[model samples]
Target: MTTAPLISLTWTDHVTGRQGHLVIDRLVRGVSSGGLRMREGCTLDEVTGLARGMTMKEALHYDPRKRYIPLGGAKGGIDCDPRDPQAYGVLVRYLRAMRPYIERFWTTGEDLGLTQDIVDRAVAEAGLVSSVQAVYPLLDDEAAARRRLADAFAVEVDGIGLDELAGGCGVAESVLTALDRAGVSREGTRVAVQGFGTMGGATARFLARAGLKVVAVADVKGTIANPEGLDVEALLAARDAYGTVHRTALRAHDAELPAGAWLSADAEVLVPAAVSYAVDTANQARVTARWIVEAANMPVLPDAEDLLSARGITVLPDVVVNSATNAWWWWTLFGDIGADADEAFAHIRRSMRALVEQVLTRAERDGTSPRVAAHAVVADRLPVIAERLGWYA
Candidate 1:
């Protein structure tokens, strides 16, 4: 049996008849943290599961020594294709309708199908102070924290924003850590990433820079494969906001395969950084990689993961792999790190490396998957957090 969410509400848009859902899985210090995502078929159950994942993501990062503390998990999702002409209006209406929750309980930013800039613009248009204003009160100095976070977001590294690169840095570190533990050489390691959006693109860039060959990348249109390794930076430059690559940007030797071809690409590591439940029970057999590093939330289904485990393909769970982005946001806002890109990157690498090592060590000791080990880490910390601060602080 699963724990029920603290709050669940479905709001119907009066203008377009579209529906949006918000699920506050838990609240710590009277606030919950998560992101708002927009997709065509987003459901309450999906939002519920994501909200719970947020809880675990938060708890897994809890450290008494760190200045940044983890908040409870919550998530908001809308059921509408972001490309629709009416999508922007639906978003504004959703934000307007959920204003009270935004002001009091939920602290949200961008997730799938939405960008932080879009969310910020819509939030302002909807008369909200900020997308993350709900957690302002918890900060020691709200104004200073806001300024720090603003400055951090303003800083860009190698043509990409620091905010965008943080998560991918963490994801890449997890892969490298796994490879190191297994005695695999990064020089010849091949990686195939699905989705060239924020997380996937960043992961590809970092891994490529780290001496890993990004042999294949899949976007909405199809998979672009190069056995000798694709030019990651060129492909990144050709991507639109939605991450679809321009066909003209491909090299003459690049092979355009079906979008799902990324699943079976000959790579040592596979990254599913786009949609949820991408690697399900049926498609699990196509995976030939030794490591499946999840950069997106809930990309692998439970039964599929069980089968993959049986086959000895280790899955680095998303709860640990993708938690860095969320942590980076809070870390910047709470004064854990400053606005410098190098500082932020260094902090993320160290933290993620340590976290991956811990999760892998525990998994080996207990003969469990990385997901189970992550959950155990969270289980150990949640009570400590609640005991020290009280549930609502």
Candidate 2:
């Protein structure tokens, strides 16, 4: 309920001079959960907003009957390109600098340019027990929880890690739920996604599998588009760790356009699955899609959302769509779910669909945007959570 973060710390990297930031927006039961992202222009303000988003995400999935209790929200970000030679060292150093918080208050994994493997490596290098060790005290069986999460992370479907696919499954499910509500058909429905990293790639894969046409996918190099629907599998296979797609993997019919062409792609759904503040007011006018489902945090700027809403373009907020990955982690760790891929996907689909339907239905009733409706839901739940759990169980 506070406007400011509980704790905000900015550190200047000793070797590269890059700045890194940590924002603990709220803590419930003495712990907060979020992820650390590494990007070229990652700022303290961005991390602050993401931390608050995490708070909302944690609250949005709160279910008292479930074994997984939502932790508070916090986030970490470093202002450096993950591809830089010094990036890994910077990550290790940043982890080392924030070891105290990681050990005591924040439970973090991968976000944006970072991956879970990289985070684990950095955490070990920093001499920490685990990236999520902060919440161990709250677990009923710390060892079992640890093994459960580790096993879940190790399980892969169709050669992609389950951890990587969980968030995208949630995003795709949100889009499908919205379409189903509108009486739209999924078969041949067009989709354009920005960024082809773990989130975007997995989203494209699931949507394509569900009979949607992924016509465009944008990455650092540019956009790959095919009106007849792209080969999502091939492209996904060609991506690097940073999500850049290889040019050679493109088919003869696949057209390479400027990176920003994704906004103009002829599609019904546009998913900004990469960076924060991607769709701004200036470029929001280029969007022709009926829906913009955010798979990345804060992709649609507030001003852009207002304009898009006025134009009758629905924008699904990221807090609800992308909360699955974090929730999946806790659900597995806390025994609500197990280490099986089918069970994880099934749970993600059920929960995300229910959440999307709830938010959209509330928005229709309240005459508000989905973001506002989601915030209202969080507002109602936060107090209940605190009242019942006493803020620090």
Candidate 3:
């Protein structure tokens, strides 16, 4: 990967407190895009690394069958009290402050510590052009899923909106694809998801509904389990605002398991979508899941991934599992918008499943992990891709 260029911003406010070390990495065609994150423990390097990863995400997500609409990578972070009452106000100020840069050069959506409502309000407060109104700089005439979303962004400012639902669906598709490639049958595949938030919760529900037996789930507070299969929709409904299932709620259905119990659940698929670095070298051995889908970025680090690979665990990279959500190729192929909720999800499901199948097949043929194989394909084309778009000389 080429070295990334960086942009830095800083500010202090009496009402919202202090936030600094704002950064943007990897602008292409004088434009960049990624999610905005606000968290107390976030760091400058973390944000930079994430920004660079977005570039890799766009590049590695390439599919020969799909149009390669030019989109660059970038990420922003605000180190702040996510739970603070004033956080919302702070976010408004931050968005207002970022309007100048974003209006012409960047586009960001919700990520960690953010919500669709928050982004809408912030964009409204900033008096910037609505994302819907701004045409995607990429040149493509085909109707892709993202183009559908771009169109949706125009009309549905008040409706369900994008950010959308594909993250979970893509994850479920990746898990199922992995299971099939590994010769594991879906009917009896036990699954454990460490994170009951939107992504993880939706994934658990999707997988369970798809015939996989979901046996364990966790939130920050703790893990809950019932090998017989926890009631999916009930637990999802019982989750607190922060995705935590109260012990009282869990006791009624699943036995509240010990800390980190989700990692050891006798399952075939494990999705760590809650937080970064959830599975590292320290506990890679305790991980009993044969297949892992990284719904969250960098959930499994390099060293730990190596360990898992040696252990015969097939850990699909986030670039493959989480890649399709924002993949320009997908949006470009989506051809037209105005899709209802079911149509939207259905589109994503087909596209995601196809991508997963391709990646897994390539990994098998190349005799390498999906991460290595995917990156190998992307790295060769990076310079050519950049040069074609007049990004880097």
Worst 10 residues of 1 by lDDT: 384-393
Instruction: State the lDDT of candidate 1 residue by residue for 1-393, as single tens digits.
Output: 178999999999998999999999988998899999999999999999999999999988888888898999999999999999999999999999999999999999999999999999999999999998889998999999999999999998878899999999999999999999999999969999999999999999999999999999999999999999999999999999999999999999999999999999999999999999899999999999999999998999999999999999999999999999999999999999999999999999999999999999999999899999989988888889899877865
User: Where is the poorest 10-residue window by lDDT in model 2?
Assistant: 384-393
lDDT per residue as tens, model 2, 1-393: 558888999999878899999999999998999999999999999999999999999999999999999999999999999989999999999999999999999999999999999999999999999999999998999999999999998898989999999999999999999999999999999999999998999999999999999999999998999999999999989999889999999999999999999999999999999999999999999999999999999999999999999999999999999999899999999999999999999999999999999999999999999989999999999999899776755
By lDDT, the better pick of 2 and 3 is 2
Steric collisions counted per model: 0, 0, 11
The TM-score of predicted model 2 comes to 0.99
Give stretches of model 3 more than 4 Å off.
Answer: 6-17, 20-22, 63-68, 131-164, 246-253, 328-338
All candidates: CA RMSD (Å) = 0.9, 0.9, 3.8
| Winner by TM-score between candidate 3 and candidate 1 | 1
- Candidate order, lDDT descending: 2, 1, 3
Cα error, residue 267 of model 3, in Å, equals 0.9
Model 3, C-alpha of 145: deviation from truth (Å): 12
The deviation in Å at residue 105 for candidate 2 is: 0.5
